[model samples]
Target: MINQTGKFIVIEGLEGAGKSSAIALVNDLIEQHTGQAPVCTREPGGTPLAEKIRDLVKIADASDPLSDEAECLLIYAARTQLISNVIKPALAKGQWVLGDRHNLSSLAYQGGGRGLMPLVKAVSDACLAGFTPDLTLYLDIDPKLGLTRAKSRGQLDRIEQQAIDFFERARQTYLQLAQQDDSIIVIDASQSLELVHQAIRSQLLHRLPLLFANK
Candidate 1:
């Protein structure tokens, strides 16, 4: 077996941007090189306590609708739980972390969509102790088409049922952040599934030296 080296790879996108498909591709490549599946985690959930926090944020109760500020606080609380309980320990053990989403989601959704960038950034600064993904694969897609795809799968969740403009704003934030960060790579998720996978493969080939450095 190859030597165990830790790395954190995150898959990010608006809903229906094919994040799951992208995650599978990245997971496969890492497994092929390491001979083991990476430790998989999803934001807003991952640990038991975090999962409860996820439900609190993702479910809508009109009788007691959540304020945007409270939602942001709750998300960070859950994120801290996952990061401290799951992600950090795994990395310390030299295991890769294949995360479904991470702090970027809050930056885009709460900060951009909900127009709480200042609050989100402040909370992020407080909770995040300089942890960041080694690489982020951002699958960019049109929110209109992405919503259609998300709807086809099943009923929309609380967040999924947000106004189209909300997703549009979030998309813009994701693109903006990608532009500013070299560690974040943008993939045209609007393409066919195979094409999306091909793009991910090419990027991994170029940037993922850890997997092959010892080969």
Candidate 2:
């Protein structure tokens, strides 16, 4: 049931909000509806150049640390490559793009965490030209609990190594933006895995019913 047009859906959350599982859940539903797999992407690294930037973002040098402004620029650079070379083309060709994360991450992480909303928004507007997802599922979780969960996986990345206050600030930004935008929906990720999945499913059914109508 591949439609003539494609939709872009993004999943947003801090570390350890179970984004990977949530992505799998949504991807399965979309595949079932379209009878094909959507093009899956992750921010900061969907393309070859983007992938390199993603590594750089995660493992910064302690010698001359990346400035907040510099980090924002690098992210947008990666995003530009992803959008110009990957995401936009996929959408234009009537292929659904399922993104692991998107601009929202920047707003939350860089804008809120680093107190650079003005700079991040400016860069976003210049780079995206108002392009955005059809639907965004935000998995909300407590930063402390989320980081604890993240810790079990392995060593934290440079971004993940931020202080508790930084993540709290980011979470607040995520909530504020979600409240302002109808396209963004917040799901309580603090719930059990099954419950989280259930909420995500219900949201898809409510927000994008057509995708599930035939299937």
- Candidate 2, residue 105: Cα displacement in angstroms equals 0.7
Which sections of candidate 2 miss by over 4 Å?
210-215
- Candidate 1 clash total? 0
TM-score against truth, every candidate: 0.96, 0.96
**Model 2 quality (TM-score):** 0.96
How does candidate 1 score on lDDT? 0.91
Q: Give the lowest summed-lDDT range of ten residues in model 2.
A: 206-215
CA-only RMSD, every prediction = 1.8, 2.1
lDDT, residue 198, candidate 2: 94
What is the lDDT for 78 in model 1? 94
lDDT string for model 2 (134-177, tens) is 88999999999999999999999999999999999999999999
Cα TM-score of candidate 1: 0.96
User: Candidate 1, after superposition: displacement of residue 208 in Å?
Assistant: 1.0
